[model samples]
Target: MPHSNSPMTEVLVAADCWRNEPDAEAVIQRAITAAAGNVDADVAGADLAIMLTDDAGIRTLNGNWRGIDKPTNVLSFPALQPTGARSDDDAPHMLGDIAIAYETMRREADDEGKPFDHHLSHLAVHGFLHLIGYDHESDADAGAMEALEQEILAQLGIPDPYGNREGMD
Candidate 1:
């Protein structure tokens, strides 16, 4: 088991339509740990929905929530307001929702010539950061976020997911 400064995070995963993947819960737990390490916030709980459907399902969700019809690798619906404000005052704080497209992630990993575990870890960490109000809309912002991702991935024993040709086999 990974050592966590805080107690176990209630990371609820709903594989509504994914397939051909083993140990979804374990993968999710690793992601949560990565997230917790990067941020100083407490991850009391999270509600993540993993859909293994085609682009159409993701498109619908993207359009309805994000107002964009394109299918993305992962979409995070953070249960937090900007400035890291909490919406609830009496509860342990639901971290928010993350939706991942199984096909898209798998394809991206193969095309990028990276291992599935590495890519999945990257995406999960990315989504968790979003839940904690981390965004990369600029080069400087991207650099900071990417560096943080690299650090967390390192802690999890995953190589640089962005590509480390020198270390790859």
Candidate 2:
């Protein structure tokens, strides 16, 4: 648990559709808060940015940063570490940025037969975990990360995202 004096994590959301889908920002923020709470480390005072964009936007970013020409549902860019030691009075740590592709997310939800909001929340949690240094490149690492995601999603009243999948088993 974070110290009582620690500030709450600040979530800055940027999305053109947020006004139309009023609950989108709230869902993203809730996922971030829940995941941070469940993690072992204290990221209570961290700041993160979430950008909601279209598939084309994300595809371009993926190409530019990762050399992949496809659009992903979500992408996380962790903040670069600062060199040397500094005083503890600096501003809250900027955890990094997360971007979600609206079309990709919606398509995935439809394909998976899951609610759109739930799927969005899952992606938000996934992206935040990535920002906090979680990866799924190996079997052990993926299992551990999936367990954490299941726990956090359960707390948010969502069912296990990996259960009953065709190829996941």
Candidate 3:
């Protein structure tokens, strides 16, 4: 639903890292751009913020926002209204924020035996989808969301994240 004349989306990334990776910001920006392009909505004029932080930072945020005291890989805070309605035009559409935990993500990649970069891309796509109202609270919803993630990742030359895990005990 992107308008033909829509402007380019803006991505702002901030890394608050204790153990940082080279080119992390650039990688995240690429992932966000790719994910945004795949979405149905016209996000050409939207602005997205991504924060690369460690487990402690994300754990604090999770506690404050969702009352969870532990850290997760990624957390998305959507700015669009609950009804999916856009705000006023004067205000550039801020598509919420995505926070990623480095330790958790790296550990997960090691555990899964996947490349760190590829896993990071998957998480970025997953978080971007959440910003656009995608969820997996149910089996059907999970399938749809995972399918979209797979499609997006494929376009980015990344393998299916759930390929080996799916249908497993």
Candidate 4:
């Protein structure tokens, strides 16, 4: 949060199905900002993208990138640089790109008995953590990441997303 600002996040709605959540962009922005602050990551002037797409759109990305054939709720593609200094260059250093699936996220929200925005916020925060090098690939790593996610979301008035569940994909 250099200059007391978060990353320059671009929320792109690439699918018509995402229209179902008119506040998707706002929710994602808020969640990402909060996550950056909580993690003390100085991402100001860094560029990131949040793609709001449907299952099919995300599936293609997953297949191409992760060698997976199915869609997931959220996927984060972290760039080479985590954050960068203010520069006069035309493009700021990229932090990462996060893609979220509308149908999958909606289904998860309903199935988990959580509000759509709550689930959305969690996913956004989770993805942001990944962009900043947080991961749950191991038991200890998962605990630390999950704990931070809970703290960040709680500050946004969102309940503990892992209260009733074992984990998220």
Candidate 1 CA-lDDT value: 0.70
- Pick by lDDT: 3 or 4, better one: 4
Error of 4 at 14 (Å): 0.7
List, residue by residue over 15-126, the lDDT tens digit for candidate 1.
4445556765577677766668667776545444433345677778899998997888888877653366556665454566777777788889898888887788788788
Rank by TM-score (best first) = 4, 2, 3, 1
TM-score of 3: 0.84
TM-score of every model versus the real structure: 0.78, 0.88, 0.84, 0.91
lDDT of 4 by residue, 68-150 (tens): 99999999999985354545855777888999999999999999999999999999999999998999999999999999999
Candidate 3 local Cα displacement, residue 85, angstroms: 9.4
* Top model number, lDDT: 4
- Worst 10-residue stretch by lDDT in candidate 1? 5-14
Per-residue lDDT tens digits for candidate 3, residues 1-169, read: 3334232444344445523577776566677777777778766777777778888889999999999999999999988554555557566766788888889999999999999889989988898898788899998899999999999889789998998796653
Per-residue CA lDDT of model 2 for 1-169, tens digit only, reads 3333232444444546545567887788777778877887657666778888878889998999999999999999998866767568976677888889888898899998999889989999999889888999999999999999999999999999888678886
Q: What lDDT would each prediction earn against the true structure?
A: 0.70, 0.82, 0.79, 0.90
TM-score of 2: 0.88
Q: Model 4 off-target regions past 4 Å?
A: 1-3, 82-90, 166-169
lDDT of 2: 0.82
